[model samples]
Target: MRTRTARHAAVVAALLLTLGAPDVAAAPAPPPPDAAGTADAESAGAALVARRAALAAASRGGGASGLDFGACPAVEDLPSRVRCATLRVPLDYARPDGPQIFLTVSRAAATGARGAARQGALVQNPGGPGASGMHFPLVADLPGWERIAAAYDLVGYAPRGVGRSAPLSCRDPAARATGPVQEPVRPSPAYKMQRLAQARAYARGCARRAGAALPYYTTPNNARDLHVLRAALGEEKLTFLGASYGTYLGAVYATLYPRHVRRMVLDSAVDPDPRRVWYRNNLDQARGFEGRWRDFRAWVARHHSVYGLGTTPEAVQAGYERVRDAVARTPAGGTVGTGELRSAYLQAAYYDDVWPDRAAALAAFLRGDPSVLAAQAAPDPAAAAGAENATAVYTAVLCNDAPWPADWGTWDRDNTELARTAPFETWANAFLNLPCASWAVRAGRSPVAVGAQPERLPRTLVVAAERDGATPYAGAQELQRRLGAGASLVTETGAGSHGVVGGRNGCVDRHVERYLLTGGRPGGAGPPGAADYRALRAPRRWFVAPRLVAVHGEDVGSEESALGVS
Candidate 1:
């Protein structure tokens, strides 16, 4: 997922409202219909209450796991690695004794030298509903990560619907269609109609492809699975560090199993509200992009001579519109069409580290050279496989977790209004989520009311970016508000990326490292609004800002002008 250019517009989109809703009241679950539904709810409820009781009992007596690392498995293909037995859990908590699902578990032996077994096992997930965590011990090559990994017998698991665990694959023709893109959204009826149809089709396609499994793939269910994994690992209490969506998972775990937690770190946190899910979150994300866009515009204005688009920001914007209109009508090689533009634009928005390269690529393309832009824009086939799997699971779980408006008209009305204010990813994101329209399975419980104030919880660390478009900093504010004395929020003043874990802002990075290593969370309350926020150190300089500006919005930086053709 690495790229050289800023694709400033792309980053603006990716960084868009990354934070979750602050008021995380769980959606109301349907009232228990029959005795079976009632009984099942009670059982699930009992299991949760029992788990909490066990955690309390364990704390009083000793810890959760009584067994120590007795005998190690013989080393094989990957020496220093050992596979533990899978933890069997219900595919449907409603039928706890019915079809069973196995949770895959893997770990590296604690490095015996240097008194490295500092704490117990450190369980980690590398984000992505699709990213494989089974090999995290060997793959996480971060500078100081090894010390912790060596000492903690780093552990990882494949969540129910991904990797080595049972997976959901989508083979529908509708699912295979590339989603449409709409930016600087217009008032055309055609654009609106196409967007509505696409969303419904995508939801239906997933429901058909991923059957019964869809209902059980929710964040709360995943939290329950974590407890079962804890039992198998024989760890009395679980220690965790999650990034991006992983942060949302971690937050759910804390809320559901408050006592079983030994310690937790949520970086680039996701909001916990079910209603907001991915839909409303994208709206807040649009604003985040606007902020980064303004930052980029100022930077581009300063370096106008180098880019040569224009001297003032307004002129630079005119330049971008010219390229966008020209490319829409006549793309380079014809093959590199709007779809590729959309994908390339999305790729560029993922990081602040490469904005300059993206600007250069656009400038080159306008001047009749597309080699650099093509090289960066083309999709990686191997990564695409993982993207497909992750996206399918993401859709299935999201669609089943709650009912999106079945009425396309309602969606049309909502989106039309959204386009007026936040046109950046509104329509494009709506198309991406088209699958929910016809999801095969019925909806599950929406989130119930979550605590408005912090209660019994352990000290936790939260990392948030001021201008993150994906998970906005606002959710972090809510999380900080609820966490009270038990948590600390570290604001990355100048950066805009998802999750502050290891993306390389030293201030945020050091704060996260310290918390993970010594349970040290920096104390600070960030500014109230996104615009009022500041960067931790000097804001990191970016070259890719211009291209990112394209996807996020025209608000970031004015677009580059096309050079006159000979």
Candidate 2:
């Protein structure tokens, strides 16, 4: 996922065009890396040395025995049942004895009467390409989560370069302190040049600090690491739950190790098209989010008595624009600028549950109170290092997983054209991924071809919201089609939240629970709509105020925050 500052700007002219044009030609593959000289051989040698050092560090407490489980450090509100451990896997699978990296794994033991006969570990990932899953097991307390835990151990792990694992850091503290903080809106020729320079500098910093490890940070590698974790946990087959980018990772894992999968659930599935990898997905997201924002406007209009913004969607939108213009001219609370205002409201596109908070913030801003807006605009600086690490990992994985166009001309031409229709996030999304144009590492492999071969894979359940702005509903449909009969798609009709399961949607949760427990697939399947299932309604409070804070930290322009492309 791209950051908010880097992923939410727009091109005004493009906003006037039609939405949903047919697919464009796929991006051309990048040229192969230098492979004909001593330079190549020397580069290979250096990489091997670094890998060895990483392996040595990972081997500190255990040698080849896998993870060493123990009590986790006291995390204030983390569940008491959660246990933490670290597992070492080769940084490069081909070199088993080469460098190794540790993955921080957390587990919630099954608590049902059939605990001893538990199905196996259900590994979970919350996406972000960078989001940490260390606390995911704590969700066992949620309605459906406990049932899932009853059937199997809930396992969550921070992928190789995230959280308590051997994290990847690219930004020098000093550089980050002084670098450009926000992307320019409707970038001018000069702004584009400046962005290009920043992109190059960011790429160079990553290479300088983590180049040796960057190649190994691809999704394919992460999948391989998953298999290693599976083995370490003594599981014969992997049962998994992944959301957003996690869905993409799950797809890759299933494709590579089909028979190893037992039961899998992918929420907010990503389109597995190599061409769309990161860039095209963001374009799709721009259109999707615009639709979602319109939905928010309509919702706000319906409650005009409470908000007093407007009694019509257009009027509400105009009110928002007035505020946006004000911020552009003079920031709110001397901190929330035009960009921050956009970022603050962008969450409304992700989940409607936060609408009230967003509504309250907007009303407060209009009432001359910018505190909430300022808080959303400027995140706690103490969290900057962690946020940078997540961004670094996000960039490394995306840029290295598949070949991104190296030619600036391709990006310029494509984004310029896309801006014509999907204006809201076009420029920002382009800048979010701009670093790939000057990425220092060559892609480790071609994009994984994810398709279901039912004969080799087990039944899988795919969940998506009908109006998910980030991953978009179309990607879920495409993923279901690609996975063929091996997959069953469940859609939350009329809903726009990015992550659907475990959000107190009894209708969606029931299908998920049945699939994970009894392996009983939903019958008469076309695309099971959330409205079809009749069960208890989710608590009113759920939709009123879901946790606004993202699982990892400030998501900014990231897919986790806005696009769900991670």
Candidate 3:
């Protein structure tokens, strides 16, 4: 679910809100009391201490059987009602006493007793294989989510190797600084050699830094950890809402523990095909992004009077290429080159609301003002560690969960072919994942056979955006079919965004709310055999003014940064 470039760095930082301490094995030493910490750090530390205390208090009730929940330390912007706890689980399921890791869990309790009685807990994951879920409970404050919050405890947790868990830090700071930018369309042989060398070095860094824990970071293990958390929470069955990569995690959980699942909602789903585990999925993403770019071009064309970039899609595209060429010749802000330009504007593919901003930025750059480009290119010092942790976890999980071709030739041939059709992101995506070819840890097990036994699972709801660049719409349709009679597919027919749930589509949100709250699904109201669901053709304005869908009066924006599309 990795995005094309550094723009997603902001998203990872925003969503990596930590509510508890990192597991002892991987926790970093605390900064000196005199040292200034970001507000995010201070709040995360305080909440973690409080959560540990609560977990200790709960132990008195029944050891690990009853979770003694208590108020989280007051963090700015976090809902006052949310409670936090830390649950320790076996680092390796095969050896329960070998070592221990902790998962930080948060819950926004149901509003009333009756609502609480209907559904016990609604566990959630916000899609990054690396993204933190500590802040997820805050969604309870949103409009449509109030009913859900009233009906079930909104639960969120940081997965094993993510923030405030046993976080992984593998990349050398120097390596990251010197990392190669997106490759040119037709790079020289020397450039290929240089990137491959960097890829190998990166793989070595992970092996040296992550060491033992790297082997256990696969999706199945994360699913196993979910089961343990479920038991600790005293829930007989799991009810979950997972977006982006979270959807893949949910599917694996249902497949592994079908009977343990009570209900599930998967938005922006990953294709479960083993062959497309990651490498191929990224290739598919290349194609999706190309289409999304075309959409962006069309939008720019529509606003030609304002942007003055072009009056047609082709002209707009040409304008973009001109910018790329100019940046390549002389880097803007001394850092923003063609790669930076691509990364900055790629946001338009994820959410339509950003189209205007992106267009404005592009127009400014074309008009001899590179400030916008420079501002976007500047890296955030505060997000450095979180970004490293996310990159580590993302690589660990994807590399270890399934096999990748060890030969560079396979990648070269495949990427070359993909570039012929989907040039925007093919090379970038290929290089981003190149390290997997030389990953230190071998593929631990076969990719989870997702949708392997969908009939054995309970009723589930699947939502997808028609032109979603990250998780393409086809994957959602395929997942729905695999889930068979028990699953319903809700399509945002023309929406290009990656995340659909709670993104202000009343039609989609209502269906999600109904399914989660009352166990009611969209009936067979569409044409016969039409996936047993409805399709909402998003309004044109839906693309232009995404803020209209802000939840709880605050824009949830796009989760694309946190959850890489495919």
Candidate 4:
């Protein structure tokens, strides 16, 4: 069913330069339960042994036997050397002798790595339990990614419930809610009730269609898959680079299997304060969006000559309201509505790269060219499909990961109050997550205790931007508080990009590369409390490669951020 809230948090899906599904392989049923845990564990252990051996052989350019090292499918934008294969893992680890699902894995085998040193397999996860990492390795094609690609076998995979793997779906075109935001929002009790019903219906629809597998779609399980991937790749310990929500996934993997993590880099760290796993994390996101929205408004105001919107933020906002009012009254080209326009604008808050195009698109409309507005506001169903799938997993993981406020009253009051200060993303975000109130799967499970015990975990490095509205800078600070005894925080000042490393800030990239390439301390990296080790700050300049700039008219300066691609 169509709904007022199609997908929220465009930032999650929008992160990596904007980045699907295969039908072929249905997972084979697990070995008979009569064979039980021990036998399955033994069998899995043996398979890992064989996989590790075959992977080692492949690494040395030896015969590729045992491992399914074949050419990757033609569909992906992968580096030439990248190979694709599949790994089977139990849907629920607790019951290993049960249903088994296949996870599509890709690898860019190391080339002439510097020092001829192969740092084992560098496993990656691009956030979203929905964000398919199948092509995350594609980021290797980016300018500065060459070194990491060469030093370690870059690995990407579709999380269990994403892509070719046992994908989840809750989409019902019939369930789509009608009408766009018709007027300036005046949130009333009746309006709240209407949205709440949409949220509930969406939740119910998910259960009706995909309820059976919802319980197992979680971060802990995701982390386990990484562990299995590590073993499959013949790595003694996992070398991981995760961004955004992937940071949370990595952290969980570390906590659950710390001894197995050789090296880990978490970019744009998520707030790990157990108290704010998701429910609170999202509210904080609204404020971040509000702040980014201001930056965008000011940018548009600055380009008043080009956009003809206004010369001040207030004037720019007035112009926005004009467009909003027009679309609310009459949908643009019979498709772009208040909701679509708002979602389109939401992209600006995610990345400044789109500000010019987005502003120009809206400006053309204000100038009586509704076609420009219509084209700008047109929905991408393909994107929407991926997002809804991601949303499906987002809800499943978030709802199953920890407890959310089950009472609508709490959500209503909190979001209503928050809207007073940050209206741009508040209610939209609330609706995005409101399904949790009626989630078919019960929550209340405590989130992983990330920094509670860092002894087993290696000294980790976290990169974050002061203005990253997606995860927020507070998360980095919080990570330090918890892992400070062993971790370092790289703070990118004055930047608002989501993830920090694929090819963003040189300073942050240097730190990450040095850490990954050289292993631990004596490699020029200091102790956890050392100057740069503890808190490394980036220069003010951004490096925007032409390919990274997708704005219309002029570019947002000659700078770009990383492909955090999570």
| Each candidate structure's count of clashing pairs | 65, 14, 2, 14
Where in model 2 is the C-alpha error above 4 Å?
Answer: 1-65, 74-80, 113-116, 173-184, 443-445, 452-455, 525-566
Sliding window of 10 residues with minimal summed lDDT for model 2: 16-25
Worst 10 residues of 3 by lDDT: 548-557
TM-score of 1: 0.76
Best by TM-score: 3
lDDT of 1 by residue, 307-380 (tens): 77666766655665566665567654444555566556453345555557656766777787867666766545
Model 3 Cα lDDT, one tens digit per residue, 209-234: 88788787888778767766766676
Best by lDDT: 3
Q: Lowest lDDT 10-mer window, candidate 4?
A: 550-559
* Every model's TM-score: 0.76, 0.80, 0.82, 0.81
- Quote the positional error of residue 79 for candidate 4 in Å: 6.4
Instruction: Give the candidate order by descending TM-score.
Output: 3, 4, 2, 1
Q: What is the C-alpha lDDT of each candidate?
A: 0.56, 0.68, 0.70, 0.69
Candidate 1 structure lDDT: 0.56
Which scores higher on TM-score, 1 or 4? 4
